[model samples]
Target: MNLVDQGAFRWHTLWLERANRSNYRKDGQILNKQAFVSLLTPPGRGAVATVVVGGQDCVACVAERFDAACGRRLDELVIDRIFFGRWRSREGPGEELVVCRRSDWVEIHGHGGRAAPASIIQDLVEDGCREMAWPDLLWQTSADPFAAEACIALTQARTQRTAAILMDQVRGALREQWEKVIRALESGDIPTASASMEELTQQSCIGLHLIQPYRVVLCGPPNVGKSTLINALLGYQRSIVYDQPGTTRDVLTTHTALEGWPIELSDTAGLRDQASGVEAEGVERSRQQREKADLVLLIYDASQSSPEVILTEGSGQQHLTIYNKMDQRSSGLDGEGIFTNALTGDGVGDLVKAIVETLVPLPPRAGQAVPFTHRQVKALKASQVQLFSDQPQTAAAILRAAARVGPVVSS
Candidate 1:
């Protein structure tokens, strides 16, 4: 069975934080570490940026461009001391920076949210320091590719939910999970190995979504207050609400968190048989959004005399029936759907909780092992399939390769 159809591995993140420690050592590349420069921290603007200069001549290389304000030479500066200084460059006047000497490397902390760090890195590279991407440089520190990948994936984590899970893998939970599979295979216990692999494979729905949030699309017939429902869920006026039918003539998407898990909510154009021109195109897009959504909210105008006529909606899609504008409705809902007054925000809380539960009914806890990438999921499933088939031993071999290699392993 294809358990996860549209990119949900069905896992949670408490382990993503386990892999942030810097080990800085890899095999056969010790000699290459002699003179190198890299942005040790994640790219983009932040409070501060850290540029790492390491190797045999790292001290001299940084000293040539940096001048200490205390009149102390770079070589004579105390190790680990936060010395304030100016990093000189030929193009223009330099900016104030804080340089700290480590046992083997010097960390240059400078103004972030600007191009200063990149400029300094470029100058260092011209100074004969080899430049490397943060992940490739990190890969050299540990032979454990899983931990290395966890460190890399941590940078892209959108929510704490995802980062925490990646951290778990970095702290050895990810590798340990696979080690169990390998041990079972080595013992000739096919059942144990296959079951374990399948569980991780099943977790792909949650695991893969840690970085990529699940897309929840709001859709229904025209003038059903779809805009109001989306605004109520988002706690703001994101979608334009109006009395006119097709106000939102396009798919409007916004990122939000439902019970801590990141989810993308889409306010799409209403579906109507009479829509034409741009409105018709929008209606078509709304249908397309429903087809791709992780969850579809089939909204209904509770005030309408014939709300139940559209009951047989959203064919072949997982959806939740919601009765909106409840206060305006004349008759009782008969407990058929979740009732809400989108304009006043009544019953929205229950709807939010329901959406989260529908997507991830059982969230993964701390220390739980999960496959956080598509390649990892594919590898687990392929291994499990082979374990029960002709390639019995290939399961263990694949798991080993996945841990050794980053992200996806060749199955």
Candidate 2:
């Protein structure tokens, strides 16, 4: 697939429907709002448009607008059977209007026009149909929004690893983890509980490792083959490699899979003590990127002897030192890291393996308790912090708060 053609071939239609309910409460508790979803996204210009509505009054509201093509009224229709119909506006006097209604819901199968669906939705809104955002609709009625989000994420996720991990999470990995922890707590097994918490934390971190790409920044002195190392790992010419010291004037990025983990690898300008002008700014930016990176690959050319390369203080423990040009005469340095000839693609796989090891240390169990959102993680951390603090009651309160974010039964 061409990156340039991404989303270009499709004639996109944007939905601007707002969540609406009778008596109008956005909190969703005042009235169980009917929810709608579209199966087909624009690009295929299919003749028919299908909108699915879900909620308490979905079937009844839809039945009112529908006249089944088979001479069946939606009010007397079966739950799963499709009724062919021309929906007319109830507010209007006659059958000049058309919309499709189903059991407890309505599907307006109209001509695929730029404005037809919008016009239909507007008609529904005018007739007191509540238009709601997909998220709000799901959250109000679904058992777990995180699980639903996970399902959606799996559908859109790019890689097989991502799809697999998200699918498992949605299937009850997090719930299982919570259940194990709660069970241990109920059994008065404090040691088991502590161990379970630690395991849960590790599982959560691993889940994050699965879904999000880890940022790995390359840093080293000028002319140490930092760009060369990046190209070697990526197996493509992603950056300009030059004999000159400051060839890479800005940070260049390329993404690749390291083992099963996704990685965002950055090749930044060489860090040096002094630079004339823009190169100096580039060097400062390189330092900042290094500090922010999840992993830093510090490169040093084996040919260079004067200024020994070492990681700066802010570089994380995930940092790996690359000794490039290892084919040259030995500089007598030895370590438990990669020694590579970036020019020839030798030992780059070993470097990638090291990165994968750092990113994902183990195969996470299918049903592990992993926080699916940053909010869940934050709440869990807050609970853990409270647990460690002197106030036991406060810690319980924090746990309750975290429990509120998910389901209390899981907590």
Candidate 3:
């Protein structure tokens, strides 16, 4: 039999068993089987968008709006099968899309844009499926907290490496590690559990940044190549470039991925004491950006005298000093700094590598257990504390609690 038949047979058997024990009708009708619809893909212009409709009677609801290209009705489509078709709306013809039927769900792959997905969702809603946000839908469908988090993070992943790591968690990498720790605790292996918790806790620092981009701010005295360098790094002219000082009077930000890690680069106004009004405001904002940035690039013109005071001021923060216009004669200054010519894109590649290394000292390996949320970190820390207190049972309890799934509701 086909996959659909197999799924139907299994579902029918389970339904019958439940019916025998409860209020399900003998006519094969399920009670209180509410259908829900959610947009599985990000809402924006893209190559494709996925809309998921699930629960009992969802197939019948989708069947009313879907017309298969092969002349097959939606209910006639087999589970685990893909059908190319046109999704119709109440007004007229809608966008052409691909629909996949599953045991308890239907996935609609449609053209990605504001109107197409919205139209499809409206059609589904009109057909009696309740609309739900993706995160809430994910939380409801996932088997565990780790799986739910993995599903949510997968959507925001900016690189294949990050996506692969989340996929590992979804496939039980972190869950397996949690089980190991629990088993170790049950067996009175405090040291083993403690060691595992410590390692995973340390890795959490990097894990938490997987879905969020690192903020890198460029700050320096006026007339330095900060704007030019930013343009070169982004491979586009996002910041206004001019030879005059104070050309960039406000913070200009752009996002990009460096070495498969997401990063947001900010070009700030040059820092100087002699400023007033708008220029002073920009300088103040620049300082604020430097204070909060994950990494600050303190730039100086290689041909000019170094500002030792600026470097000293930025020393307290995580920063890198870069000497621009290396094509010109080097200033007789002595200190550690990267030399580059933003005009020619010289040394930019080395600069990118340095940024990546500084931010992510040790990239996560595939299948590694890393905590991505504050709750997970707190749980790990609690387990560690219990592990050292001669409380194996308590530690085991904490470990299980850490792995427990919590309700995630959308705001």
Candidate 4:
């Protein structure tokens, strides 16, 4: 099914319309004053979780269940001020929470974990505040598609660098460029508009992979320390290590963050000829994985014969050759490959660096116009196509359409 038909994407559009209509109260407060609560952080075991409560009764709803250490009532608390307190639920003395007031909105910071956020949300729900997902809230708050996309991407950002880049988009990196393109097209400056579109298209290649991790595959013959090297890279024992050949009969994958970029490291069965039964199937699977992998680490034992044949087999794919068992006696057979001792963790860091570099040769600059989502990419492509056509007005319309966050709402 198309992305627009998906539940999340549909909600993105529906909630935006709802939020735009309910954004203001009778008192002219530019906030969603219908008592609603949404999680600002992912659901998991973490140091803290943030819940955002907004609407006319947001402060009152929270105050009913919250007791500040300073003994101040919710109405007595100053706006834009933070107060430390305990939340009281029917269950008993509630968890420790930090409350902050922002006009009609209130923020609750509490302990992280499934139980804590769940309990806190339940309390808010009982207080007449409806629970909403983070993504839906983000869509409602964003001004346009670029901003909405940036907000969604920021939530999934794994590293500081990625977050900074996405933050730039939220601050109008892509929106500014799109606006510029629109202005240029309006003024009959097709060259400028085309140039801006081309640049954004190029940046999209790396931008799309920012939130989504690049897939890297580890492949080599059995007993060559493929599993060992994988374990070293992951900083844990994720793959099984056996002295016997063909110990791993299937693909084993683990997700990890390297240098702030998300990556999926896959360990595949050793590749070799004339394997019987299951071992042969493993070897075939390894080859398949190499073909699909973003980057393949061709590992080999330095103490063994030349791996030229293995290298030649996987030559078409982007790969880095690694000579494992560097601690043992050298085979003196080397053309081009990083040497490493999986047992001692020697040269493992360099391997990771190489993989990251191979995947993303040059990182996108801060605040650069990048199209991360498929919808944005498709819109960009459509604009580019329209740019070459005889109809400049059509191109301008397409660019304007791409900048829209959701369907138009009539008053």
Candidate 5:
């Protein structure tokens, strides 16, 4: 695939999408809500537009506007089956459509133009159905906001392993754990709550990455085989590899999985004492990115004397020193570092293992509670602060709100 074609996500590497559902604060509640209509697709040009309506009267409302091509009324249609139809608008001519009927909601699929979907939504609103934004629609449809977020995260998940970890959250691991925290608080067990909070905060390193791959930036002086190493790890030619110094003028990124863990790897412009123009800018950007990266691989030429480890303060980034081009060593060397030949793919597999193990030391297991969003991690930390401050009640309230289980009575 061309790098320029995937311009936006290519360099960014499918970064995190913040799924903060703090305001809703609901879980395991009855799904009954006022009948609402929403256009799931954007009101712009597309192939097919989807409008979902849910409530006791949702099917009746949709049936009024639909003329099924199979001569079957929605009442006779099988649930989850997409029936062909025509959406006859009271104001204008009808449009071709295919709609699926579900247990609680009925989806109307029609022309993805501005006029057709807008007309249909307006008609539904006129018929006493509430008009809702797509996000609001999802919030209302889901029973638990935390699990709902997990579902959303699962949609963007890159690998089956990550998806499995996230699926646990969707299956009530997140909500159940928060429920435990709230229970401990209600029962005045501050110690237990604090310990759980600390553990979950640590899990944020893995939980927050359920959808986004970890940011792994490879950096070193000019012509140290950073590009070749990244290519070896990715098993493909993602970065342009050249033997000349400063060949990579910008940070080139690609996403790949190692040991079922998704990682976004970057090959950056070589750091050098003498640089000019775009090379200088690239070097500056690489330095800035290293500070923000979860893991930074400091690549060095294995044939030369081992370079001094660069010490960066307060960046909180884990640094792994990599001795590259082991196949071309002038002499044998001894050191505590990952040795590899990016050109021949030697020791690259061990390097990949180390990268994953460093980033995620303890992988989430089945039935484990992993707070998989910023909102969750923040709430956990905030509540821990409250507990530490001797305000058990406040901590309980915060956990309850974050869990979306509403307020619990403190015992």
Candidate 6:
């Protein structure tokens, strides 16, 4: 579904504005005249839990079923007041958990567990609560459009680094970036417009990485210290380290962040002249990772052999060759490549810098005029249906079609 229609377009904007007025709050938009319910708590276990129920007349709907423990009527409860109460399962006569409600929109903060909160949710769902993901629910009731999108983006973040980046977006980082572009457009400054658009587009791309983690693999011969390098890069022991050849018979994948870019770092079994069955399978997986990686770090032992002895050609898109264990010998790389000792952390900063520079390009403008979503892509293509038409407005109509489905602020 389109991001706007999914309710992100409004929820985010209102949520942010409300947040500005008060630190603790949530906003939601109703979908199909039905109220949206979201479990603010994470999917798994936690100490405390938050459940947000919002929609038109959310206050009324929630007030009817929620009984305040302080002997206060739900209608008499002040806005933004935290009232302690036992959350009763709407499906039956049982306390769900100790709950609290907010003024503008109600927030139920209660004791957390797998059973209690889940039962509450199940009860609500059975009682006509449209059980939805937190992001989708917020999108439905959101008053601001961009904030809604930001919420979805933030919730989908795959890594802490990515989450940090998208958290910036949610706080109007992208909006400010787009405002600069809008200013340039208004001034009829073609050069500035083009430049700003280019810059913003780069930001948009980088911003997406925060939403979707990219795969990065370290590929090379076995015993080349690939695992050692991985341990060094990760700043902790992650992979098995043994001098025995072929010890790593399978690809070891780990999630790590570099310069706010989340990467799925993989250490594959070494590629060598002879291989056991397991090593062969690891080698095959290495090849697959190399093919899929956004960037590949090819490690070669400088003291042993050149990269040519291991991998013949460089990747077409993006890759780097590293000469590791430089402390053993200062002979330097026999061929052109980056040199580093994953053992002593020598040149590790450079390795990280190279990775960041290669992967995290700047983001695009907010509401990119061009199609970024599948729906917009399809709509733009359909506009071409009139390319061969006789109507004089065909080209203009097509352009309009592209624009309509393109970025536009919600009312």
The TM-score leader among the candidates is: 1
Clashing pairs counted in every model: 24, 12, 0, 2, 0, 31
Which residue pairs collide, candidate 4?
33-55, 33-56
Give one digit per residue, the lDDT tens place, for model 6 in 216-304: 78888777788999999899989999987687778889997786567789888888867868788878777877877788888887776
Q: Please, what are the lDDT tens digits per residue for candidate 3 over residues 191-290?
A: 7877888778878877788888889999999888999999989998999999998999999999998988889999999988997889999999998888
Point out where model 1 deviates above 4 Å.
1-27, 30-34, 41-47, 68-78, 84-96, 308-316, 330-335, 406-409
**Global lDDT of model 1:** 0.76
- Every candidate's CA RMSD: 6.4, 6.3, 7.5, 7.3, 6.9, 7.1
Off by over 4 Å in 6: 1-32, 70-72, 88-93, 96-104, 143-145, 155-164, 176-192, 273-276, 305-308, 312-314, 330-333, 361-411
Q: What is the lDDT for 63 in model 6?
A: 66
* Candidates 2 and 6 compared by lDDT, better number: 2
lDDT comparing candidate 5 with the true structure: 0.75
| Model 4 TM | 0.73
Q: Scored by CA lDDT, what does every candidate get?
A: 0.76, 0.62, 0.77, 0.78, 0.75, 0.61
lDDT of 2 by residue, 217-303 (tens): 998888988898888888889899999999988888888876667789999988877776999888888888888788888888776
Q: On lDDT, who's better, 4 or 5?
A: 4
Worst 10 residues of 3 by lDDT: 7-16
Tell me how far the alpha carbon of residue 157 in candidate 6 is from the true structure, in angstroms, after superposition.
4.6
Question: Which runs of model 5 end up more than 4 angstroms from their true locations?
Answer: 1-35, 39-50, 68-85, 90-104, 109-134, 306-314, 405-411
Best first by TM-score, ranked: 1, 5, 2, 3, 4, 6
lDDT of 1 by residue, 1-411 (tens): 122210111111111111113334433446245688877544455677778787668899999999999988789999878999999897765999999886667889898754988999999988899887766666655667666667667766777777788779877887898899889987898778778777777676788888788999988888889999998988888999889998999999999887778899999998778899999999888888788888889898888766634433555667788989899875644547788999888999989988988898778779888888766777787777777775767877877777664555555
Highest lDDT: give the candidate number.
Answer: 4
Question: Higher-lDDT candidate among 1 and 5?
Answer: 1
- Model 5 is weakest, by summed lDDT over 10 consecutive residues, at 11-20
